[model samples]
Each structure stands twice: as structure tokens, then as C-alpha cells.
Target chain A: MATTKTPSRLVLNGLLNENPIFRLALSMCPAVGISTTVMNGLMLGTAVLFVQVCSSCTIAAIKNYIHPRIRIPTYTLTIATWVTVIDLVLSAYAPEAYKAMGIFIKLIVAFAIITMRLEVFACKNTVAMSFWDGLGMGLGFMFGMVTLGFIRELLGMGTLLGHNVLGFRPLLFFALPLAGFFCVGFMMAIFNYVELVFNRRKKRRG
Target chain B: MARLRRITYLTLGFLLLAYLLVFSGCAGSQNRFIKKTSFRGTHSILITFAGPVDEEWATKASNYRVYEKPDPDIVLKISTIELSTNRQTVILHFEEPLNQNQPHMVTMRGIMTEGKSVGTAIVKVRKLYLGYLFSILIGAMLVQNFVFTKYLGLCVFFGTSQKRSTAVGMGVTFTIVIVASAMMSWFLYQFFLKPFHLDFLQIIVFIGLVSLSVQAVDTILRKVNPMLFKAFGVYLVLVIANCIILAVPLILADNEYNAAESLMLALGAGLGFLIALFLMSSVRERLELANVPPTYRGLPIAFVVAGLFALAFLGFSGMSIF
Candidate 1:
């Protein structure tokens, strides 16, 4: 699979086809939980991106040594260790963001997307490929989270990353968990629709 | 092959033994049963039990003795020992007002529950407001719902909600697993982690316990009732990865809730998930027949409906139930 796919394709796959939150619908917990504000979403996404890349790179490097029978636990321990390290660092250095995102950060250890990447791509791929895959997937997650965060923040609070955008009272519902579903759903629809039209135009011209 | 099987069995047996030893060792410690003491008011301090105490044993005034520490002369007599309806909380009424500045030692000797002795427990009273438990419940259910509010288990939330039957099954399973795991995790956190100052390891420990219990439940269900297991087995396995199961304990620990409050929060959160799933599934069933654009079909439409539902649920906010 890695042989056929170019590095750019892999990156694009992560950002588009296999986008963890929007396309594959993985890790929606943090996406909804922390995406009430753009800052919260960005911070949580950064944490996940860091953990995902580190875990991917490490798993790729050590895939040969891991026993098949115990691979799941080993992978889980790896994610947990990285999450813990990030948790400690965030709490010590970025105390305010840590206060807002502490619980969500701890939850990164159990995200299926991270484990899925390790099992599906990282374990079998080269270290360099795995790094790219990780980066793409992580960036994809960050993009989805930030998008959701941006929408929710804009609608709910009439603000974007703490700046007052709208002068009136916001919908307020967009800030809630229920609206997260709506925002993602509509965004997904628009995304697919545009892709469809884009493909149609390309086909007609060709 | 036989040797390998033997080795596997031996390893499994050793792991079980170690788990038992650690759990029993933690339970054996006096600190396990006695949680913390808090001032409910000027005259009373609420002593929380880690688990439900025997109502009969708890009601008996002679079982509990409170003394102002370092001052035997200031013996505070128990006026009334009120066991909460949940059976986890025991509100001790004292004749003499507790001094806010001084500390009090509560001793429960041989508190028997369900034909077994819980042994002795001694805890120092600390300043904790009891009024927040209600807010925690409302907040967990309505304000910070695991599904609609926090988005803990969206995979299951969206995956099972297409069919009403599956949604209900998932809801029941989720409620049971979440509440049970929350209680178990609380016990593990309080008795094991708190005593050892291993609080930082909570995330790993809580997730491990949740996954292990889910596995245990799956196996036991398969053995005892194959039909029920067959219906919910796949969903149960999927639940191990469900964020809500892990989130309950994490939220409970983050908020520093006692056993009773943790149970309530768990129940509330689970109920919230159940309500959200049921609503979404029912709406989707209707949505299936509705004419829609190609792009807005299926999950995208379901999400839009869910957003509307979320908007409806937002009405529950700002409600001062307490």
C-alpha cells in the first residue's frame, strides 16, 4: 500500500479522505468537548497532533520488536505515556490551557484514531512514511477541530478566538454538544457537495 | 503446544492473584471505608462512606463516636445518625456544635454490612460544601451531558442511533457499564491512588479498569445468558473504546466528588446519553423517508437533526433546580 501511494498522496489522504473527525468520524469526543472555543479546540488539537506524531514515529521505529500478542497493550501504554508527558508539561507551563483542557488531554490516550493509525499504517510503513502519515492525520484532526471550533465559537458566542465578532447575542446552542453534530453534519454535506461539483466540472472539461 | 497453554494459564492465574492482592490490600486499609469529613453546617459534619453501609449498623448511635482531636474533654455526642436514601451517605447529628477552627476524629468500630464487618475507619474533618452535589447532577445531565454537552461517545451515539431497538440496547448497556465503572473507578481512585499519592496515574488506571470490566462483563454475559450476549456483545466490545465510559470516572475524579455524588453523576450522564441516543435514532427513522439532496443524505442529515435536538435541549440550561 505504501509502495503505490506517494508521500503527497498519503498526506492528502489524511487531510481529506481519511480525516479523523470529519470523514472517518473518529475522536469526536474531544472534537465536541473542547471545540466550544477556537482556542480550546486548537490547544486540544495541538496536543493530539503532537501525541499522534510521536506515537506513530515511535511505533514505526519499534514495530519489529513488539510481540503480536501483546501489541495492543504496548500501543496503549505508548499512547498513555506520551499523553502523561504532555499532560505534565501543559499543566506546568501552560497552566491556564491545562485547566481548560486537562481532562480532554488525558483522554487522548484512548482515542481510537491514534491507535488505528499505529495498527494500520505506522506499524507496517517506514519510519519516514509513518511520520508523514502521522503529520497528515494530526493536521487533519487539527483542521477538523479548528473548523468545528471556529463555527461553534462564531455562532454561539459571537466571537472568534475570544474576539467579539457579532454585536448581538449568539445562537448559544452552537456552543452546546448537540449543535456540534449539526455543525459537523452540515459542513460535511457542503464538503461532499463541493467535491461532487468539482469532480463533475473536471470530468466535463476532460 | 500443551506447554504453551500451561504457561498462558499460569500467567493468567498470576495476574488474577496479583489483582486480588492489590485490591484486597487496598480494601483492608482503614482509609478505604472512611472517605473524608466535611462541615455540612455549624453543628454537623458529614462523614462519607466509600460504599454503602449497613443501614442497621449505621443507624446505631453506639457504632459511631466523634471526639474533638487532642481534647478528650470535648466529646461530641451523636444526636442522630441519618443514612441517606442512596445508602452511601451517613449524616451524623451531634448535640454539641463542632468547632470550625479545630479538627475532629470520627471512629467507626466494626461497622457490619451484609453479614461482614467493614472494620474501623478514622477520618479528619475537612471543609467541603455539601450543596454542590445537586449542581453536579444537573450539570452532568443537562449542562455537561456526556453525549450532547461533552461529546464523549459520538461513535456509539451516531452508530447505534439509526435503529430504535439498537439505540435502546446501547442506552441500557451504556447506563449499566458507565454507572458500574464510575463506582468502581471511584473506589480504585480513593482507596488505591489517593492513599499512594498516584493521582497522576489516574487516566491510565481508570481506562484500564473500564476496559477490564467491560471485558469481564462481556465474558460473564456470554456464559450466563447467551441470547442477551448475542444481542449486545458487539456493542459491549465497542463500548470499551467509547469515550463516555472513561469520561465518567475522569469527570468524577476531576470534580473531586464523593462516592454518592460520583454515582449520581454517572447515572445522570448515562441517562443523558440514553436520552440523546433515543431522540436521535427516532428522528433518523423519520428522516429516512424524507426526500433530501444527495449530499445531505444519511449521516450529514442525521447530524443536522441532532443539532436541532441539541438546540432543543439547550432550553434545559439556566434551570436552577437546586
Candidate 2:
């Protein structure tokens, strides 16, 4: 596995191949809760990016020491500790942002995407590879969230990042949690369709 | 070897930064004098402070004053000031009943803490509405639904919502577990965690409580009704990891709702989940018969339907019965 794969491939795999939200459908709770506005999406994405990278790197470094039988609980404890640290830091330095995103931040402790990454990539890979994978997955989640937030905010509230973009909300339903399902599902289908077309074109040329 | 060493150093550095932030966070926010306030009755108010108040300085009537708007001349007399045993809460008793319609401003000046004046805090007392129970029910069930609004419990929601019967079973089990866990966590939080000031450990504690209760319910179900357990045993275990289960308790704790309100919230949230699951399962069952595109047949189409339902529920957003 190590001989054939490159770090860049690992990163790309997370971004396009196995995005946490659009592709794998993990951690949809926060994806819906925080995607009401573009700013919220970006903020939450940044927070997840920080926690995902740090936790993956740490898990990779300590993979040898963790017992296989109890690795799940250990992973949870590790994630919880990092989430608490981030929660405290945000509340201290950026109180206003923390107030808006604090509950969602704490909810990251139970996110399946982080756990899935730790188990699938971080445990077996080197620290560098795990870090890249985490970074890529984080970026992918951020991309999905920001896109969803942008469309939802633009349509639901007639704003983008609180700036008025439309005179009236076309469909306020986009801002609701139910819209998250529709957005993610439609996005996944479009992504798959695009990938299919790209692959087919490449195959024809070859 | 160099790369490994760098990784080690990076991990250690991050840990050190995290430690520093944790300690600094406690000290940095301690200077704020007032925490929050709420109404105890029509006439009285309960004020909570950031730290323990100096009983000698806080008990004096002159330190506290209540004013009405516009004129600002009516000073409601303080009949008594009672400090809680923890000294974090002070109950101010007014001589006369306050006007329910007019907003009153209560100011406590020169609040001493550790032999130093921590400045003053003025709080506006809005009239307390008594229909919080009804509003919480409507809010949780409709406005901020656990499934449709918050996107919690999706794993179980999608997993068990294929058939209507299974949906009903999972929903009932989920509601029971959620309400039970909410009550348990509320008791633990109010009596032990908050009093001891270990509120930071709430996440770990609440998760533990929820898992334990789920385990208990699992055992009871298996023994009492083996058939029902067989239907929902897998999802019952999944409840331990369900975001909604943990979220219910966490939200209740964060909002600091009283016992009745928390129960109502749990009920509303649970009912909301049940309703969403039931609706989704019924729709999916019908969708099985409808001809659709190959790619959008299953989950994608279901999502579109859920979105339409969400749009319908948006009509309830403007409803303010209270």
C-alpha cells in the first residue's frame, strides 16, 4: 500500500473520492446544523479542520501503543480531549464566535467522520500521510459545508455571509434542517455524475 | 528518525498550547461580575454572580435597588436579601409586588468579592410568561425538531425508517430512552456537577449516563419482551451513539431549564423524532412503488421528499401561540 500510494493521492482521495459529507454521509448532524449561513459553515469547517488534523496526527503517532481491543474507546477519549481543549480556547479568545458555535463544536466529539478517518487511515498510515488525509478530508467537508451554506443562505435568507444578495428569499426551506438531506443527496448525485463523465472522457482518450 | 522526532515535537507543542489555553481560560473570564438573572415570582428576583459574593456586602438593602422605566424615580424597597449556601446566588425580596406589565430594572452596586469591589450590574426584569411548557413543546417538536431541524439521529433515522412498523418501534424506544436519560442527566447535573463546579466534565458524564441507561433499557426489553427486543435490539444499542440522545440532555443542561421544562423538551424532541421517522418510513414505502430514475430512486428521492416536508413545516415557524 505504501509503495504504490503517494501522500497527494491520499489527500485527493479524501477530497473527491471519500468526502465525509457528500460521499460517505458521515457527520450529517453538524453539516445540517451549521450550514444555515456561509459564515457559520466556514467557522465550523475551520474548527473541524483543526481538530481533525490534530487528532489524526496524534492517533497515528500513538497507534502502536493503543491496544486493538480497546482502541475505539481510546479514540473517543482522544477526540473528546481535543474537542474540550478547542472548546475552552474558543470560549476564551473568541467568545462571540464561541457563543454561536460552541454547542456544535462540542458535538464534534461524536462525529463519525473523524472516527472513521482515525480507524481507516490514521491507524495504519504514517503521521505525515495521516496528516495529509486529515487535511484533505477536512477541506472536503469544508467545501461541502460552504457550498451548502452559500446556496442555502442565498436562497433562504436572501443573503450570503449576512450580505443581501437577493431582494426576497426564493425558498426559505433551504435554511431548515430538512434541506440538508436534499442538498447533500443532490450534491452527491451531481458529484458522481461529474466523476463519471470525467472518467469516461479520460477512458475514451486513452 | 528526524521526521519521527519532528512529529513528536509537534504533538508535544500542541499539547502544551492546549494546556496553557485551558488554564488561561479559567482566569480570563473570572472578572465578569454578573452571570445571569431570572424571576422567582411576580415580586422577587434571583440574581446569580460570577463568583461567590461577600455576604456582608451583599445583604445590605442599600446595595440593591429596583427602578421603573421613564421616570426612574420609583425605588422598590428590598424587604430581604438572602444569599444561597453556595454564595453564588442571591435572592432579593421586594417590599411590594412588581407591576407585571411594566418592565423593571434591578441594579446591584458595589458587589464585593474577595475584599474587592467587582463593580455593578444592572439587569432588566421582563415579565415572565408562564406558558413556557407549551412553547417548548411546539419549539422542539416543530421549530427546532431533532431530526428535521437539527439533523440528529440520522443513522437510526435512515437505517430504521424503511418500514413503517420498524419506524414506530424505533421511535417509541428512542423516545423512552431519551426522556429517561434527560431526567437522569438533569438530576446529576443540578445536584452534583453544577454544585461542585465540575460543569466542564458534562460531555463525558452525560454520554456515560445515556449509555448506561440505554444498556439498562436493552436488558429490560430483552427479558420482558423478547420479540420487541429482537425488532429493535440493534437500534437500541445504536441509541448510545445517537446524537439526539446526548443532544437532548446537553441542551437541557445548557439552557438550565427547570425539571418540568426539561421533561417537556425531552417529550417534544422525542415526539418530533418519532414523527419524522414515521413520516419518512411511510413515504419511502410508497416510493418503492413509484417509478423513478435509477440514480435518484432510493436515498436521493427520499431526501427530496424530506425537503418538501421541511418546506411544509416552515409554515409553523411564524406561529407564536405564547
What is every candidate's C-alpha DockQ against the true complex, given to 2 decimals?
Answer: 0.52, 0.33
lDDT of 2 at A131: 92
* Candidate 1 chain A: 10-residue stretch with minimal lDDT: A168-177
* Model 2 per-residue lDDT tens digits across residues B1-322: 3433443454355335434533443321222577766667767888888899898988998988888754588788889889999899998888888764455677778789888987877776644433545677778998877777566777667778899978877887787788789989999999999999999888778776776788788888788667778877988866755788878888988888767667778878887998999999999999999997766756667667876777677677757555
Instruction: Specify the highest-TM-score model's number.
Output: 1
Runs in model 1 deviating more than 4 A are: A154-160, A163-178, A199-206, B1-144, B226-232, B320-322
Provide TM-scores for the models: 0.71, 0.69
lDDT computed for candidate 1:
0.78
lDDT of 1 at B66: 84
Report the Cα RMSD per candidate.
10.9, 14.2
